[model samples]
Target: MKYFRANRPLTINEVQKFAPAAFADKASLDVSKNYSFLSTRNLIETLEKKNIVPFAVAQTKSRTDEAKESGRHLIRFRHENHKLEIGEVVPEIVLETSHDAKSSFKFSLGLFRLICENGLVAPCSILDTIRIKHVKADDSDVIDAAFEVLDSSDSAIENILEMKRKVLSIDDRFSFANEATTLRWEKESDCPHLPLEKILAPRRRKESELDLWTTFNVVQENLVRGGLSFYKLNDKGYPIARQSTRAVNSIAKNLELNRNLWTLANKFLNN
Candidate 1:
């Protein structure tokens, strides 16, 4: 619940100090120099306005306290200059149809990390989740691999590998997210070649185009009319099922991990 923003470049140790649950392999790489936290609420709102459906796992206050009190579940995300860092949350990755296996999904929701302080979410490419050590954000470069495009006819593995090489060669920065893996990109080099800039940039302008009042009204109507269902994880890390007619709750359910943590942090800070 405590939203942590980086006042300065955060070392792994520093992040661990605030949220001990952060990934384990903090020693190998200097993640402290990069990445920041983001408000999950603001992040989801931004995504929804852009019409991007991001699938995420919900954590409650229990998880929140576990992270803040002992830094046991801390995860980090790296981003550039506070742009929309977390990529499109892939909804296809289903961990379970039932509730018991939810934690599996929690770990699979891409490696995107939230910078608690400024609400700046970033890719958690460089940090190792199990060992919690830092690795090359772009292992595609170091490891020489290819990524499978969600849907592409010409997207062969070889092509993906080549693209990966080129991207990592340029943008040395690595991004981490939820899915036990890393995504590497070389910004300047990759963008011009494939319009990555246009594709990657968050539709910030598109969000601004919508009149806030109108958007909220529409969202409100959907909440009121729609059969809304969600799993509300409280500070104790317990799932609470309820119905709501609030767009905000939708945002909360979608990006619940960040929301629950942020909620707990706010509660702790206020109390």
Candidate 2:
């Protein structure tokens, strides 16, 4: 997938370069006659009226010509009320849909930390998932649903606070990182084992904390922006040449990994 992200809201032209699907006026020819065309641009305009503006947008690289303009795309926006202060967790609205009839207008809550690089803070708790089936675009519903997703911030914040309050010992922190590696590569026995230390180290001094929140952020950023090196032994027990993990950009894979990481964090929180 190709994506554009920033601390400030992205302009339509900027978003268009990454996700032309957002501007498509008609549904894909593959859709049935009953399928109604709902433009993502209309929904974005509707939400912007309520001060919910897009900060990041992305789409899959389409292979077929017909799917080029109707492929799945995602827009991540934040409410005007949320402060974009560095090192603080902020709430956001994640919206995804496509005109190919393969996706519906789905809305979910997200959290982000405004560090120098603008790392995403995965949703810590179970948040509402709003799905709108094929229908003519309506502003009122978009506005209401956006606010409803934003309302989930309270629970998200609470979860973050709890994670911060519970401090972890060095060994515990490494354990968390170890589990994160498994989440990234399920059935590690079948894959080259990633070193826990690579993901455990924080990029900034401020992020080096023995708490769940900070630890989660460190691991999440490393796993998502992967360049970690690990060696795997081949059939004869001879080590294969060093290989680096690739950054995850597939929409489905990224979402699944993030949610899995979130679930792993919660399990540690409760124990």
Candidate 3:
């Protein structure tokens, strides 16, 4: 499994060379000169001040290799182990993506449990994302967002511990899985009306824990990266049980699912 696709960080000059169109024209030059563009150097310097360093940087290219859509800089912060909780902390790269022929810049925060290293993006309800339009990009805002995420770590970690303490009953697990299915499908009619036994089946024995935290992770992984298989008719008109692929869905789906699941967990704790 290749976690970090780009292992080396590309300099701003190198990035400009790789995608000259992104830096072309007088407007681009003005943006670049004003430090309004969040370059790799800016990201490196901001993170380094907090003692966080990027381990990998991947420059994603379009299908035709004619354009660059985004860059992913992977960084793993030092894991913290408290008497009540233990987990790995990871932050995602901030980058711009082409949406509807326009550039949208944003960054996400994530976590990986030391017990399983199952990476999950922080739910938006718990942590607000930083988004800046390419035209009005501000370096200060970007840096502030980074600091905000870093500062919220303690609260996030406490929530994780709270979730771990809340054990899921068999019925609770089933209800959670059903809700997960609803969130996974855009349309209610398109959802599979299978038994919770099939839907909540763990991908591995290690994920069989009854705690809300573990159950959430199991369902999350299955939803984002398909795992559980069901029999479906192939072109041959024969039913076959094929294992699901590990490919992830769109960023929107990722954020939606995470937010929904986090909300569900919060409800459980409150009740």
Candidate 4:
């Protein structure tokens, strides 16, 4: 995906005109009544007025050959520091298809962690998200709702920082690995489960830092990106070495892993 830094807010028409290839496929005239289009241009203007400058935009289609209505655009903003680190805030506005009704449009919030650049959807438990049902809301309402969430990012940053400050012991790390393994392989009876030792293996020497933040990333990398090894039967009926694939491939899985991992880490602090 090509990302362009926005110096000023651009309207949907301007975005389409500027990047015809990305937004070339226009929505059909009969697009679903439930779907409503948010004013990207107005959103940008609102963000800029609040000193929230958009730094990047990504356009993607839900599937190949799908109409433009199925396409989504991601707008990203750096909360304060451009540097990536734990507790640093990166907010993203996703304009995409609505779940309430097919053929309608909605905008959702996503967050990015600097440590691993992991993108997290804003959990309803944490952040207030705006859902604009075309039937009930107008463009101004969408803009107002989006600003409400963006303005409350300070609280979100505080939550992230609190998590980062809590340290994890060596035993806690191992326990986390075991719990993560259970979460990853609870359904796969045929697959050989990875051992806790292997899950705790560090990809880099620096990753051995004894903290909940680093430990979570180390284990998460191994589970989601696949760096560990396991055995499988070959055609000759002999055990052969096989590399593990991503444990979480879909968005739902990603969200589950992130939420569960954080919840697990939070337990240590609570205790």
If the candidates were sorted by their lDDT against the true structure, best first, what order would they fall in? Answer: 2, 4, 3, 1
Candidate 3: tens digits of C-alpha lDDT, residues 63-140: 543333233222333322222134444444333333222344555566655455455666565676666665556567
Runs in model 4 lying further than 4 Å from the true structure:
1-31, 40-45, 48-69, 79-116, 120-125, 128-130, 181-186, 190-192, 233-238, 247-256
Give the 10-residue window scoring lowest on summed lDDT in candidate 4. Answer: 95-104
Which is better, 2 or 4, measured by TM-score?
2
Could you give candidate 2's per-residue lDDT for residues 1-271 as a string of tens digits? 7458887788889988888899898889879887777778887787778888888898998998678799999888887666666677788888778999898887778777778454353553667477777866454566577778888888888888998998988888888888887778788574566667888988889988889988988898888887878887788878888888888888767776787888888889899
Model 3 vs. true fold: TM? 0.70
Write model 1 residue lDDT over 158-214, tens digit each, in one string: 322232233221122111111101111124332111122222222233322122211
* Reference-based TM-score, model 2: 0.90
Q: Give Cα-based local distance difference scores for all models.
A: 0.25, 0.80, 0.56, 0.57
What 10-residue stretch in candidate 3 is worst by lDDT? 75-84
Model 1: residues >4 Å from true position, as ranges? 7-9, 23-74, 79-102, 105-208, 211-271
Give the Cα-based TM-score of candidate 1 against the true structure.
0.24
What pairs collide in candidate 2?
none
True-vs-predicted CA distance for residue 56, candidate 1, Å: 16
Inter-residue clash pairs, candidate 3:
none
